[model samples]
Target: MTRDHPADFEEIARRFSHLWQALNEGSPGTRKILVDRVRDALDRGEARLRDADCDIVANSFVLEALINDGAATRVYRARHRDLGTFHAIKMPRPDHADDPVLRKLMLREAEIGMGLRHSHIAATQTVLRLSDGRPALVTEWIGSRLAELLQQRPLSLGEITSVMTSVLSGLEAIHAAGFVHCDLSPLNLLADGDLSRLKIADFGIALKRGSRHSQFDLAFAGQPDFASPEQLAGEPLDERSDLYAAGLLLSLLLSRCHEESDGTKTLKALTNHLSQQDVQDRPENARAALHLLGGSPKRPVDA
Candidate 1:
């Protein structure tokens, strides 16, 4: 019976089964073992998908196909048997679906996404358990990413402000909901119809307001060069971290060239305000940055 099916798929299933065992064991060593096994599984799976003439994500709402394969798991855009629409299906690398850590990450992202309700934030539709016993967080598909837009050309001032407004609005909602978006970067930001509309994506590494911050600095995860000192030092963060990221977004917006000459000055001002390397330095948060941008719409008086 198995011979009728592909040998590669069979091998992948066997490896996945082994990985499941290792993850269920729930030890650091077991996790490491599972990680390697999952990598092999993904490679095989990708080949099978290609052979089947399938895209990374399934086109039909009824079929399940791999959409996003993140560091820890593979997600499929699938139609639920009951719900009858396309939704995100998350599982812990086929092998580690039951792993507590992976399970927690999935739930955490879903909760954060649901809590943050804004046009600029990816909306969480629902979270449910799959028939195969894996967890899924269904969300509105925001389509392609900001990276695609910026690839063509840099955004204009008005365009950037419009996008930032949405992003900041979303951040405000996120902060109000009592969570910190530990990950914020161009890749995580998505564009809808045009550059003016932006949506922040990927909440996997987010931290709740009162939770103890991670020891390893995640600031580097977003963009180390753009990170504020507090993030670089792994200190407890507030709205200031988001401001630092916004400043980078601001720099990208205002700079005439991709690498603006005045970028250093702007970053310096923002870093001083945020990092407080000097005791006398005044702290400027995202709100303050927005205030600065507020005046951008007005033309400077001829002097």
Candidate 2:
């Protein structure tokens, strides 16, 4: 009789047989040693699997460098093989690739993003499924994260207004589309050099307007610092919830700037209004917030 064996078949069989024998008739010390050996072998196998999964690549794009190593996903700067254009490719971390909740979040982000077309919103190009069944999101490449930029220097009044104007405009579009950007923080905003362009990115935890908290868990939703009072309480969310986050974002930007100016005082008051503990105390929606910011309502631009 002939038999086929895998590369590690002999090693695996030896370990298993030794464990079985120890369990049945070996001394206590022998059993303990065999059990430890089995555990070590299992750990090695899992390590190999994790290493293989970490080397993910797509057929259409070449990953140039890792851009962001986030809690749930890893973003890479990649170039499309045929188009030769750069794009931001986001994929779930190796540990999260097979998690159903994370996969659902990625799909939800794609769906919400595909419908939103605006200059101030990072556009989702497409979702690519890897051979290993992991979904990767392709989005427009922006220069830098707002968090990174803020770390370098404080913005001038003009720069602050420009960034806030762009962000509120983007929020208006997102709210109009009937979705709340549940997660809005400095890390989620992308900006270009010269402050000419800023776009909202990452809709991974966006909630539909008026959606009940029961639909999704808020514990893992928005950032605690930027989250509205109602969001932390697990209450239903609306456009006001997003406005609250926008208010918090404005406050953060203001903190980075020089203080005690007349314009800074005015913005501080607005921030207080937007981030009021009571949901009803905040602006009704993004449009209303923009009105408070002394900006005209601009029509949404196509991506």
Candidate 3:
């Protein structure tokens, strides 16, 4: 169907099911025809649901574009039909959509995010259920990921300071809310152009303070380089665990800046203190780490 004359839900589903069956059991000629039909449906921007229940989320949001196709989830830049506001809708990959373990993880991330409200924390607006009974998280739209920005250009000392301060501030709030942001890598941080607006995103593996890690947590362990020593050991974690990751995140920023001034040296020292192998060796918390950077917890670094 053409974009102006799109296929209805029923027709789309029928084509999708036939394609699935063809791939598995149909003759070669039939499989080729089914493939072409499905491709045409997608090219026309027609909605295709793997299961009947998938329509709830598909119909609610007008997916503007695919933002990121990650290993487990696909994030879309979507506009909510009723609200008329843009958001990042995170849905599990089709293969993972029906997995109970992934559903629980997404639910847990939404639960942790809903309680957090900070300028440096990306808000989780709400969770929508897919037609197949899986959960999708609706989050504030952030156009840039820190990882992408780092690849584009080197940041100035002021930019690094600003970004690190924002991250620590976010961690402070997360810890105060009784949770540790188990994931704090560059990929999980969001920022706008010029490093002016930065926020922490992705709490898929965040754990409550003093709470034991679940089996699902193991599968989603954050980036290896950013994971704390205690986290790698599967030991009990507290705010300090997140502090370690924050320190590494700062180091990642500093590595790209290529400056060796006194200010840079100071930040490097702070990074060392934050990433100490022993939890006690690091700053007591994010607040203390901020102080070591010669700044107040409430005031961000001058950008």
Q: Give residue 228's error in model 2 in angstroms.
A: 0.7
Model 2 lDDT tens row, 123-225: 9999999867889999999869889988998777667777888888999999999998888898899987745478999888888998755575435577899
Q: lDDT values of the candidates?
A: 0.62, 0.81, 0.81
Model 1: clashing residue pairs?
Answer: 56-66
Q: Is candidate 1 or candidate 2 better by TM-score?
A: 2
Q: Please list the residue runs of candidate 1 whose C-alpha ends up more than 4 Å from where it truly belongs after superposition.
A: 1-65, 78-90, 215-226, 253-285, 298-303
Give all TM-scores, in the order shown.
0.64, 0.77, 0.77
lDDT of 1 by residue, 124-230 (tens): 87776754566767777666776676676755445655766666677777777777786777777876666555787778767765443453333334457556566
* Models sorted by TM-score, best on top: 3, 2, 1
lDDT accuracy of residue 89 in candidate 2: 89
What global local distance difference test value does model 2 have?
Answer: 0.81
Model 1, backbone clash pairs (residues 3+ apart or across chains), number:
1
Q: What is the TM-score (0 to 1) of candidate 3?
A: 0.77
